[model samples]
Target chain A: MKTFFTTGKGICIVGIGIGITAALLQKLGNPPNMGVCVACFVRDITGALGFHRAGVVQYIRPEIIGFVLGAFASALISKEYRPRTGSAPIVRFLLGFFAMIGALVFLGCPWRALLRLAGGDGNALLGLAGLVLGIGIGLYFIKSGFNLGRSQKTYFSVGLVMPVIAVGLLLLLITRPELKTGALFLSTKGPGALHAPLLISLAAGLLIGFFAQKTRFCTMGAVRDAMLIRDFHLMKGVIGLLAGAFLTNLIVQQFNPGFTGQPAAHSVHFWNFAGMLLAGLAFALAGGCPGRQLFMSGEGDGDAAVFVCGMVAGAAFAHNFAIAASPKGIGPLTPLFVGIGLVTCVVIGFTMRKKI
Target chain B: MMPDRIDARGLSCPQPVVMTRNKMDTSKSCSFEVLVDSGAARDNICRMATGMGWDVQVTEDADECILVLSKK
Candidate 1:
C-alpha cells in the first residue's frame, strides 16, 4: 500500500494522534499542558541516572525509552535502519546542550509550547513568536550557506547502539535498581512526580514513535519549511496538532483559557520568549527538534545520540546551576545563560558558513 | 457567475490549499468557492488565494468555513 504518512491528510492524522494521546496522557496523570515534553523527560532521565541531583525532577521516564525502542522497531521493519555518524558531532552536541538549556529556561520545548497554547495558556504566544524569530535567524544562516558536514554511513553495530541503550534504560526502569541507597531517584513531587502509568506512557510513546518515524514529523522542520520555502505541507500537521489538542482539552475540561495560574506556567513573558528564541535557533542549527532528535537516534543516527547525551548533560547543568526556570518565574542566572547560548549559536553559525 | 467549487472539508491544511491552487492553476475561471472544516485550513487557503492576487471572502460557520476567491 502507498504510504499515507507523508501525505497531508496522513500527517494531519499523525498530528491528531499525538494531540489526543498527549491529552489522554495528561488525563491519565501526566503533567498538565505537558503530556510529552521531550526536554523535560530527558532531564528527568538525567536525574534518575544520577547525573544530576535535582531532587524533584528525577525519574527514568519509560516514555523516552519507548520512543527510541519504538522508532527502532519501526525502522527495522521498514529497512530504514542505516547507521550513520560523523556530521559535526561536537557542534550538534553543543547545539543540543544549548537547546535544552533554552527549553528549560522557557520551561518547555516547541511541542510543549503548542500544547500550552492549546490548553489556553496565553503565555505561549510570546514563546511561539520567539521561536519563529529564532527559526528565521537560522534560515538566514542557511541562506548564507552554513552547513554541517555530511554524515557518512557507519557500521551496523553503530545503529544498534542507541536502541541497546534504550533497552538498557527500559530494563533499569523495570528493575528499579538501587541508586546509592533506595531505588533509582523517583521524584516525590513536581513535574517528575506526575506521570501516567509506565505501560500507558510507554505505549503512547511507541505509537507516536512509529507514526513520527513514518511521517518525519518535526516541529522545527514544520516552522523551518514554512519560513524558508513558504510551504505549508509540514505546517499542516502542526495546525492539526494544535486543533486536535484544543478540541481534546475542551472535551477533557483541561482548557483553562487564561494567562495566569496555568499549571506549571509562569506569568513572566520576556524570558519565556527569549528562552525559546535561543531554543528555536539551537534546534534549527542542530537540524531537528528534541523529539526529532530522539526519533533520529532510534533510526540509527549516532550523531543524534550524541545530541541526546548533550541534552541530558545540559539538563544536569541547568538544575545544578539554577539556570532552569520554575513556575514561579525565571531563574536567577537565566538571562546570562540565554545570552551565552545566543552568542555561542551565532558564533557557530558565522564560523561554519561555507565559502561559496 | 456560477463559481467553481472545491469541497475540502475533512481534509487537512495544505491539502485544501493544494486543491485550491491546483484548481486555480488549471481552470479558466477566475473565481472559486472552497469549503474547509478547520480555521487553520481556511486561513491558509485564504492566504494562498490572496498571495496569488485573488480577492477572498470568508464565511465562518460553527465548525467550518467557506471561502470565495475572485480575481481582484
Candidate 2:
C-alpha cells in the first residue's frame, strides 16, 4: 500500500536537489543556480518587451512556459482537472503581486535562493534565512486560525483561463509583434530580452508542467507540509528534481563553487534575505509558491489564475517603477514596496482568518 | 487487446501512481510505460507497479527515464 515518510527526508532531498539543479543549470548554459527562476525570468521577459530599460539581465526562459503548459497537459490527461474558484481572490492577487516584487528585489524566488546557495553565493543565505523567517511568520498566522476563506467549485471555463493565457503568450511569442506598427510587446535587450529558441522553450515548459502536475510536485508545498504536517512525501520530488539537475550539471561540467560575481546574481545580503522573506511569507499565506500557483491556476483555479495575473502585473510594476533589484543591488523603491507588502500580508492574514 | 501506455514523463510523484491506477482498470493485459526524469518518480512508479501486481522494469536516459509495466 501507500506509505508516507517524515518531513526530514523530504527536506534533505530538496537540499540535495537544489544543489544538483544548480550544477545542471550551469551546465545547460543557464546562469549558476538559475536553471529556472520564475520571478527573474518574468522580469527579464518584461524588460525584453521594453517594460523597463534594464539591460544585462534579459532573456526569455523556456522553463517558465514549460511549467504551466506541462502542468496543464498533465492535469488534463490524468483527469485531475477540477475547476474551482472564490477564495479571497483579490487578496491572493495582491499577495502574488507583492511576492513578485519581493522576489525581484532579491533577484530570485525561494527556489532560486537555494540554487544560488548551491552555486556558491553566500548572499543567497541571507535570502534563504529571510524566506524561512517569512514562512515561519506565516505559520504563526496559520496556527492562529488564519485563512483566506474556502474555494468553491466553479465552471469549467474558469479553470481554462490559465492555459488559454499561456497559449496566447506562446502565439504572441511566435507571431513577434512589431511595436512601431503598435502590436504586442517584445524584449530587444537585457535579461527580458534573452530567450532560448521558442520550440525548445515551449517543449521544456510542457514537459515540466506535465511531470509536476502528475507528481503534484510543489516546492513551496513541500516545505510547508514539512513544517506543518511533519510529512515528506511531496518533499522527495523537490529533492529528486534538484539531484537530477545537479547530476546533469556535473556530467556537463558546470559546477562552480563560491559567492562573488556569480552570473546574474548580486552581493546584497540583507535584501536577498528580506526579499525572499517577503516572498516566502506570501507563498505560505497563499498556500503555494509561484510555480505551484501556476500549476493550480492551470488546473482550473480561478483564484490561482488571479494570483498568476497578479504576478504578471507585479512584474510589470516592479520594472515600470524600478522597484525590482539588479545585479548591482536593490532598486531604489524595492525596500519601501516590500515593507508595504509585508504589512499588507500580515493585515490580510489577521483579518481573513477563519474563526475555527 | 488494447495495449495501454502511461506517458508519465514530467509528472511528479503520486500523480503518476494515481493515473496508473485509473488507466489500469480500462485495459486487459495492460502494458504501460511511465516516463520521468528523476529517481523519486522512478521509485514511486515502481512501488505503485508492484502494489498493483504489475511487473516493472526501469530504463534511464540522459535527461529522461522510462518505467515499463505489464500486468502479472
Choose the strongest candidate by lDDT. Answer: 1
lDDT of 2 by residue, B1-72 (tens): 434566554333234444565567776665877666434456556655675688988777654567778888
User: Which candidate has the highest TM-score of all?
Assistant: 1
Where does model 2 sit among the CAPRI classes?
Answer: incorrect
lDDT of 1 by residue, A140-235 (tens): 887676667656767989978988998898888888887666558888988889999999999999998888877778898799868764867678
Off by over 4 Å in 1: A181-183, B1-72
For model 2, what share of native contacts is present? 0.00
Which pairs clash in the backbone of model 1? none
DockQ of candidate 2 is 0.03
Task: Report how far off residue A314 is in candidate 2 (Å).
Answer: 1.2
Report the error of model 2 at residue A330, Å. Answer: 1.0
Under CAPRI classification, how is model 1 graded? Answer: incorrect
* Model 2 Cα lDDT, one tens digit per residue, A1-356: 11222233543554454355445444545555676777777666655555555555544466676677777776677556767778778998999999998898888887776566555567777887887788888878876767676567667788888788777766666776667733445545544444555665566566656655555556776676567545565677666665665566556755466667776777888888788889989988887778778877777778878887788788888877888887788788888999999999999878875532
Model number 2 iRMSD: 11.6
